[model samples]
Target: MFMGDGMSLPTLAAARTLLGQRAGRPGEETQLSFEAFPTVGLAKTYCVNSQTADSSCSATALLCGVKSNAFTLGLTAAVPRRDCAASQVPAARLDSVAAWALAAGRDAGVVTTTRVTHASPAGIYARAAERNWETDADVLADGVDVDACPDIAHQLVHLAPGNQFKVILGGGRREFLNITSVDDEGTPGKRTDGRNLIEEWQADKARRNVTYQYAWNHEQLLQANATLPEYLLGLFESDHLRYNLETDHTTEPTLAELTEVAIRMLSRNEKGFFLFVEGGRIDHAHHDNQVHLALDETIELSAAVARALQLLDEKDSLIVVTADHTHVMAFNGYSTRGADVLGPSNMRDSAGVPFMTLSYTNGPGRRPDVDGRRPDVTLEEGFRSPRWRTHVDVPLASETHGSDDVPVFAWGVHHEMFSGLYEQSHVPHRMAYAGCFGGGPQACDAAAAPSALVMPLVMALLALLRALA
Candidate 1:
């Protein structure tokens, strides 16, 4: 499933029009790819500690079948946010659906536009007290807990049983490499412990007698063979991958391309695969109040979903597309039928001052000019230009996440069960039930298995007939 982060219904409403304008079409007639999914459900995204959800809490709820506090991942709500001590409690640690999939004899993978260890994607295998503990530097920055938790990147390479990932792709090479090593762009490393985790990862795989490959750019990843049983990793940027709007196609593959490669690598397993693909930058764009950039990110995410659908068989595969939460960006002002979503509204207030068709409820670039003065920007330049920043009601440095229910779009096997409103924690249950993995309702029944008696007899008869011939 595709996640358009901070994508409320209104954000999507504006984005649909904005996307068509970018394609040289009338704004009203366009449809974002996932709009066509047959079943749509609303998910309540509140966390136990806060009304509005953060990515860590939402990630735990959706991936681990439990709701957690704001900054924790794979832990129950009982663990206080950032309480490094409580993070080690056995009752607080929850296993992910990915772990369950592995136990069910399925391979698993994770892909994202953000760092592989970022909050939402780390839910695939990590169980930590804080999402910010992405590197050794972070652990050193704060008071020590009774038990020292390894950073997120460390967990990916050296996690416990049932956490073996077949593929892990996205950014954050700086976290893995040594502080002395320069990045692809010749930037200094972010690591403090001076460990080259990439080498460590390869060495660990070799010890297990496993075929493995690591790629740092688009071409390298494309050239790697997926037909062979191998663990593959692609880290294209020191930090997060560049946004789709400004990235070079040659050096950076789109999210769709990444999804295709990941699926192919994981699909070699006869037991099947579980892949988590995140359009992670959409949330960043919204936080920066970059309307067009956010929508573009969403467009790329939708394409990734479409590509996955083509690669998967609907009969056995279950695809879920939903957002972790939303933004407070307002899409009002009665602009005409064909008005640009990224352009200004023709209507003005009593003082006769023009405003944007889209504005956030709270964010940066929001100014209160009592003298009625405005910036020198025109519709031709649009909000995308470096000079223009969208105005908001509140003048905060970054936009706040909204508590509104996000939409869940599902297709493929057991798609019928995704209807009706539900709690976010209920998601992993539905997924487990659908895939026949974990302790789900359908996992225990003998009927869940393929006809045991009939299948063996059929195989024996076929073998006898072949011998006779």
Candidate 2:
């Protein structure tokens, strides 16, 4: 499964055009990698408690096969955010697709451009009352007992599915190291418990008599013995990996490179493997209203998906591409053929000012009126820079998520199962059904055969009913 966090339809459309223009072709003639999928569907992204979903709950829904409250991960709505006691209830904790895959004797791994403990990737293993609790220090500062509610990073190293993962690659190394220790990048660790989880992880793997390798930079990752390690862990940065535009090729790996390595490691298991790849920094870029960065991240995600396709066998494997949520970024204006997506539009507004081709509903990019005239986006000093923020209607410290329904694209085996509009929670269920794992109805089960036949019709009816409701 591949998820591009906060990748809305608008973002994809704009990114496709931008990519084509860079290739010296008519913008509309291009397609993002996932756009070529054989089957496509839409998913409603609202959370149990909010009209607009947050990454935590949306990821839980996408991975756990159930909807959860906003700001919570791997829990049912019964466990509200910040309610540590309630989160301890066994019934409240949800098992994600990763757990299901592991239980079925399939190896699983995760790759992302964000912290491994961040909400989206953490949804695969960590169950937390609050998404911010990435380390012992964070939990302690929240007035929560670290022993009772282990931090997300601790869960990744010590918990069941996460510990069993064959390949774990991403950033957030500081969360795994002791506070007194410094990383190769000279960044201080944040754990207050003095536990160096990375070292502990190595010791655990050694105790199991299994071969493992850990890499802190791109050179080490590239030089890793391709067929030697049974498990691999790579952390290239203390926080999220640098955005692709600013990444150091020698020190940090691109999303496509991470995806390629993760596949090579996980595919060693004859029982097959389940891998989760996330373009998580796209969300961070969207929050900052940096449309250029967000679009570049989306393009990187497309490349990663393309890389995965090259290594996978469509006859047996199932590949899914979707987003956990959507951003408030809006792409509009009638620009001439092959115009720059990051530049101002050709048409002037009623006030005789050229607005950006891409803008936001609310963000730090909100411009104040000067003498009753909106600032012309074309005149901004850094308007062409990747760090430039597009214009927004409402002022906010950071842009917010949109309640828009996200698109789901599918290819490979049983792709037909994901062909109609459905709730976001239905995503993993469909995947589980197709993969014939998890407690849900499975494609391999005789009783589920009939229901699977009419699922598309039923889904279409439900969507119509929802619209009517």
TM-score of each: 0.91, 0.94
What is the alpha-carbon lDDT for the whole of candidate 2? 0.92
- Model 1 score (lDDT): 0.81
The C-alpha stretches of model 1 lying farther than 4 A from their native spots are: 145-147, 161-163, 225-229, 370-383, 443-469
Q: Give a tens-digit lDDT track for model 1, residues 1-469.
A: 4566667787777777877887898776887777777888999999998899999899998889788899889999888867777888888889898888888888888898998889999877888788898887777676654137778888887785323888888988888876888877786666677788888888898899998888888888887743434888788899999999889989887899999988899888887877888999888888888877887788888789889889899888888988888888788889888798887787875666678887788888676666666542354354446335688778889889999999888888888788999998898888888888888676335564667777999999999999999
- Model 1 residue 62 CA deviation (Å) reads 0.9
Model 2: CA > 4 A from native: 446-469
Among all windows of 10 consecutive residues in model 1, the one with the lowest summed lDDT is 375-384
**Which numbered prediction scores highest in lDDT against the true structure?**
2
lDDT of 2 by residue, 106-220 (tens): 8999999999999999999999999999999999998999889999999999898899999999999999988899999899999888889999999999999999999999888
